[model samples]
Target: MKILIIEDEEGLRESIAEYFTEAGNICETAASYSMALTKVELYRYDCILLDITLPGGGDGISILKKLKENNYTDGVLIISAKNSLDDRLQGLDLGADDYLVKPFHLSELKARVSAIIRRKMYNGSNLLLFNELSIDLQAKTVKVHDTSVKFTRKEFDLLIYFIANKGKVVSKNAIAEHLWGDGIDIADNFDFIYSHIKNIRKKLVEAGGNDYIEAAYGMGYKFTGK
Candidate 1:
C-alpha cells in the first residue's frame, strides 16, 4: 500500500516511514502542513497519516477541509498527540477515517493502517479476483488460476491498482503516484512505469493469465478485464 505520513515530528515521521517501507510498501512523509497539502493536491495515496497540529498552513483541521474541498476519496488516518474528545470529533467530522492517539504502539499503528487500507481497497476482502487472476491483499502475492505467480514489488502493486480500477483509463500521473509515492520525479515523464507494466503483463501471460491491461492510445492505460 502507498502511504503518506503528515507529521511535524521528524523522528516519529521517519520511524513511521521506515517501518512501513521495511514492510514492503511505498511510504512518504511531510513535516509540515504546507508540504502535506502540496502532496495531497499533487499525488494520491492509499492511506494518509495526518497530524492535527502543524506549524504552517494553519492546522490539520484546515488540511482536512482542503482535502474535502478537493473531493479526495483516499483513506485518512489521523495521528495526533491531542487525545481530547472534541479534537477527535472534529477530525472525524472533517472526514478522517480513523484516529490514532500519539504514544501508541507501532504494531497497533500498522494494524490500523492495514485495516483502513483493507476497508478502502478491498472492502475487507483479502482476495481480489479478475477473471483467472487473483491477488492476496494480506500476503501481497498474486496467483493465476490458483497457481502462484511471482511478481516484483512494484509489479504487484501496479497490478492490484489496475485491477481495483479495472476498465477505467488511469493516466500515467496517477499510476506513478500510486506505485512510487513521492519518491519519483513524476513530472519528468518517467519511463520505468512502462517497463514495470510490461514485466507484469509478461509474467501474467506466462503464468496462464490473460493480458487485461490495454493501452489507451495517447491518454493512458486501461485494465480491460475479461
Candidate 2:
C-alpha cells in the first residue's frame, strides 16, 4: 500500500516510515504542515498517518479538512499525541477512518492501517475476488481457481493496485508515483512498467486466469477484466 506519514517528530516519523516500508509499502513523509498539504493535494495514498500538531502554517486538522473538501477517499488514521476526547472526536468527525493515540505500538498502528485500507477497498474483508482470482490480503497471497500463483513483492503490489482500480485506465506516471513515491530518482524510462505487466499477464494466463490488463495505446494501461 502507498502511505503518507504527516508527522513533525523526526524520530517518530522515521520509525513509522521504516516500519511500513519494510512491510513492502511505499511511504512518503512530511516534517511540517506545508509539506503534508502539498503531498495530499498532489497525490493519493491508501492511508495517511496524520499528526494533529504541525509546524509551518496549518495543522494536521487542516490537512484532513482539505482531503474532505476535495472528496479524497484515502484512508486516514490520525496519529496524534493528543489523547483528548475532543481531539479524537474532531479528527473522526472531519473524516478520519481511525485514530491512533501517540505512544502506541507499531504493531497496533499497522493493524489499524490495514483495517482502514481493508474497509476502504474490500469492505473490511481480507479476501478480494475478481473472476477466478482469489487474493488473500492478509496473507499476501493470490490463487487462480485452485492453483496458487507466486508473485514477487512488487508484482504482487502492482497486481493489487490494478485489481483495485480495475476497468480504469491508469497512467504510467501514476503507477510509478504510487509504487516509488515522488522521492525516488529513477531514470526517465517506463520500460520497467511494461516488463512487470508482461510478467503478470504471462503468469495469470499460464495459471488459467484471464488476461485482464490491456495497454491503452499512447495513454497507459487498463485492467479491463473483461
Candidate 3:
C-alpha cells in the first residue's frame, strides 16, 4: 500500500516511514504543513498518517478539510498527541477513518491503518474476491480456483491497486508513483513497470485466471474485468 506520513517530528516520521517501507509499502514523508499539502494535492495514497500539530502555516485539520472538500477517497488516520474528546470527535466528524494517540506502538498503528485500508478497498473483509480470483489480504496470498499463485511483493501490490481501481484507466505515472513513492526518480522510464505487468499477466494466465489487465496504448493500463 501507498502511505503518506504527515508528521513534524523527524524521529517519529522516520520511524513510521521505515516501518511501513520494510513491510513492502511505498511511504512518503512530509514534515511541515506546506509539504504535506503539496503531497496531498499531487498524489493519492491508500492511507495517510496525519499529525495535527504542524510546523507550517496550517494545521492538520486544514489538510483534512482540503481532502474532504476535494472529495478524495484516501483513507485518513489521524495520529495526534491531543487525546481530548473534542479533538477526536472533531476529526471523526470531519471524516477521519480512525485516530491514534501519540507514543502508540508501531504495531497498533499498522493494524489501524490496515483496518482502514481494508474497509475502504474490501468493505472490511480480509478476503477480496474478483471473478475466479480469491485474494487473502491479511495473508497476502492469491489463489485462482484453489490453486495458489506466487507473486513478488511489487506484483502483489500492483495487482491489488488494479483490483481496487477496477474499470479505471490508471496512468503509467500513477502506477509508478503508487508502487514507488513520489520521492523516487523513476518517472523517466516505465521499463520496470512493464516488466512487472508482464510477469503478473503471465502468472495469472498460467494459473487459469482471466487476463483482466489491458494496456491503453500511449495512455496507461486498465483492469477491465467486470
Candidate 4:
C-alpha cells in the first residue's frame, strides 16, 4: 500500500512511517502543511493519514478541501488529537473515511488504515475475485482456478493495482509511483516496469491463467481480464 502521513510531530510521524514500511508498504511523510499540500497535489496514495494541527500556516481540513477540488478519490483517515465528536464529524463531513485519535496503538492504527483502504478499493471486501483468479487480502495470497499461485511481493502488489483499477489504462508513471512510492526516480524507468510486467505475465501463464493484461497501444496497460 502507498500512504502519506501528514503530521507535524516528528516522533509520531516516524513511528507511523516506520511501522508501515516494515510491513512491506510504501510510506511517505510530511511534517508541515505546506509540504503535505505539495505531496497531495503531485502524487496519488492508497490512503492518507492527515493531522488537523500543523506548524505550517494551513490545517488538515483545508487539505481535505483541496482533495475535493482535485477530485482525488482515495481513503483519508484523520489522525488528530482533536477527539471531540464535532471534529470527528467534521472530518467525515469533508469526506474522510475514518478517524484515529492521537496516542493510538500502532496495531490499532494499522487495522484502521487497512479497513479504510479496503473500503475504498475493494468495497470493504477482503477477498477479490475475477473469474478464476482470487486474491485474499488478509493472507496476501492469490489463487487461480482454485489452486494456489505464489507471487513475489512486487508482482502481487502489481496484480492488485491492476485489479483495483481494472479497465482503466494505467500509465507507467502511475505504476512506478504505486510500487515504489516517491522514493525512487522513475523518470527513465520504462525498462524496469517492462521487466516486471513481463515476469508477471509469465507467472500467470505458467499458473494456467489467461492473458489478462492488455497493452494500450501508445498509452500504457490495461487489465482487460480477457
| Residue 41 lDDT in candidate 4 | 95
What TM-score does each of the candidates earn? 0.94, 0.97, 0.97, 0.96
What does candidate 1's lDDT look like per residue over 122-193, in tens digits? 887788877897788888889899789998888988998898788899998889878877666645775888
In the range 31-127, model 4's lDDT, one tens digit per residue, is 9999999999999999999999987889999999999988999789999999999999988999999999988999999999999988888888889
- Model 3 alpha-carbon drift over 4 Å, by segment: none
* Cα lDDT tens digits for candidate 2, 1-226: 9999999999999999999999989999999999999999999999999999999988999998999999999999999889999999999999999998889999999999999999999989999988899999989999999999999888999999998898899999888888789655565798888989999999999999999998899889999854
Q: After superposition, which runs of candidate 2 have C-alpha atoms over 4 Å from their true positions?
A: none
Worst 10 residues of 2 by lDDT: 179-188
Clash pairs, model 4 backbone: none
Better of 1 and 4 by TM-score: 4
Score each candidate by Cα lDDT: 0.88, 0.92, 0.94, 0.90
TM-score of 4: 0.96
lDDT of 4 at 79: 95
lDDT of 3 at 190: 85
State the lDDT of candidate 3 residue by residue for 1-226, as single tens digits: 8999999999999999999899888999999999999999999999999999999899999999999999999999999999999999999999999999988999999999999998998999999999999999888999999899999999999999999989999999899889888755745688989999999999999999899999999899999878
Compare the candidates by lDDT and give the number of the best one: 3
Residue 171, candidate 2: Cα error in Å is 0.4
